[model samples]
Target: MFTPQGPTLRELAVQALSSVERGYDLLAPKFDHTPFRTPDLLLDPVARALRELGPYETGLDLCCGTGAGLGVLREVCAGRAVGVDFSAGMLEVARAGGPAASYVRGDALALPFGPVFDLVVSFGAFGHFVPGQYPDLFGQVRQVLRPGGQFAFPLPAPPRPGSRGYWAMLGFDGVMRVRNAVWRPPFVMYYRPFRLGDVHRELGRAGFDVALRALPELGERPDGSPRCRLVVATRRS
Candidate 1:
């Protein structure tokens, strides 16, 4: 679901044919118009959660595309805020107009900074990483965080069985699997596989004491579970 100003069918097709980095580069200008950009609906509540957890200094946003999470960091962090991503084009857009933060171009798996941040946040970028890469990604985030620091992000509940969303996600992942099997420089985006149970275990193995906070603003499911939750992973102090 994209806006009138968003990339066209042809543009999206072209992007799908390219590598992830190059595709994002081509889409960066119109990214916010697309549904791909992290929305204020999610970011606002995450900001509130961060505020309750901190008066943190020196925040970082991992894979901070257009810098929405960086804005959240600025709201909660009293000091310097930074956004990091591998895409120079995305970083350029991010630096153009966001809550006055600097941008760093670097891979998420090999984050460049040391244990310098008191808080780290990411938004709408997890699908880019596969299950096997979770350890390295978590490790990189841990490496950049102070012992008592937090790594936080909002995660929506999976679509219910037999729902349109459920089928749509399954179909999309299936398509991606086929594409990667036959294509070069695979896109590597899959929505169905990032389960919360597995994620909690992985974060624990990566030395984070994990916790969950429901975002009431996002409402709840029919079965009374939170529609969305904020995963707050803290490095052991």
Candidate 2:
């Protein structure tokens, strides 16, 4: 669902037909007005979780879109904060509206820094990367962090089978697959590609000791499981 200020149906169609980076560039100005942007409800609880876990010094917001996650980092990270993304248009908007943090346009798979941050956070950007790329992405994040530094993100529980949400996501992914197959410069985003088990394994291989913290603000499922969790992967001390 999009607000009145969000991209029009025609604009969204144009974006879907373009490459992921280009699509995002086209969408950058109205990104915050769409449901696609990471909600503050989710960011607030994750920020609280990180604050409990740290008084971290420097932080990075990987693939920091319009820099929503950077705001979270600013609350917990003491010294400097940085937002890194590959989209120049997105970075431009971020630089204009974000907190007084540095914004860099760079690839997440080959981060330019080394052991420079005490914390790194990402939100809603994983779907852009396929499952196989997780190892390299995690490794890059690990490489950029100091010993005992953390890489954290919030992950909501998967939708239950037979649910409307489940069908909606499935339909969305199916449409995306069809669009990519038929179009050039395929826009890659799949809702179910990044499973938790695979992510945990990839993080382990990337030399991160991973743990999950329940985000109580999202409440619990019918099975008494947390509806959302913060995955905190720490580089070994």
Candidate 3:
């Protein structure tokens, strides 16, 4: 769902027809007004969790659209906060918001920084990455973090197979696939592509010690599984 300030159906249709980067560029101005932005509910819990683990000096927000997660990083990171994304338009919106944070427009697969950050956080951006790219993505995140630094993100538990939400997501993914098949410069975003098991393995391979912290505020499913978790992957010291 979108707010009154969010993109119109015609605008959204045009974005869906463009490449992922270009679509986001077109959506950047109203990104924060859309449900597509990472929810503050999720951001708050992640900030609390990071605060418990941190007294971190520097933080980086990977693919920081409109600097929402950068706000979370600012709360927990003491010295400096940075946001990096490939979309110049998103970066421009982020700058206009005046997050007392530095911004960098760069590729996630080839991060430009050294081991300059104690923590890295990303929100709602993984869907943009195709399935086979996780290893490289994780590796790049690892490359920018100091030893013992963390790469954290919130991951919701998969929707129950027969649930309405599950069906909705399935349909969304199906529509995306159909769109990409016929469209040029395909917009790649699929809700179910990033699995926890695969993520854990890839993070491990990328030299991170992976762990999951339950976000208790979100409660648990009927089967007693955590509804959401914070994936905390620490680089080797």
- Each model's lDDT comes to 0.92, 0.93, 0.93
lDDT of 1: 0.92
**How far out, in Å, is residue 185 in model 1?**
1.5
Candidate 2's C-alpha runs over 4 A off are none
What's the TM-score of each model vs. the native? 0.98, 0.98, 0.98
Query: After aligning candidate 1 to the native by TM-score, how far in Å is the CA of 42 from where it should be?
Result: 0.7
Task: Tell me the tens digit of each residue's lDDT in model 1 across 51-111.
Answer: 9999899999999888878878889999999999998889889888766988999999999
Query: Model 2 residue 216 lDDT?
Result: 95
lDDT of 3: 0.93
Give the per-residue lDDT digits (tens) of candidate 3, residues 1-237.
Answer: 257898999999999998888998999998888888888889899999999998899999999988999999889999999999999999999999847999999999999999999999999999988879998999899999999999999999999999999999999999999998888989999999899999999999999999999999889999899999999999997
- How many pairs in model 2 have backbone atoms within 3 A of each other, for residues 3 or more apart or on separate chains, i.e. clashes? 0
Q: List the residue pairs that clash in candidate 1.
A: none
Once all C-alphas are superposed, what RMSD does model 3 give against the true structure?
1.0
Could you give candidate 2's per-residue lDDT for residues 120-168 as a string of tens digits? Answer: 9999999999988888899899999999999999988999998998999
Task: Give the TM-score (vs. native) of candidate 3.
Answer: 0.98
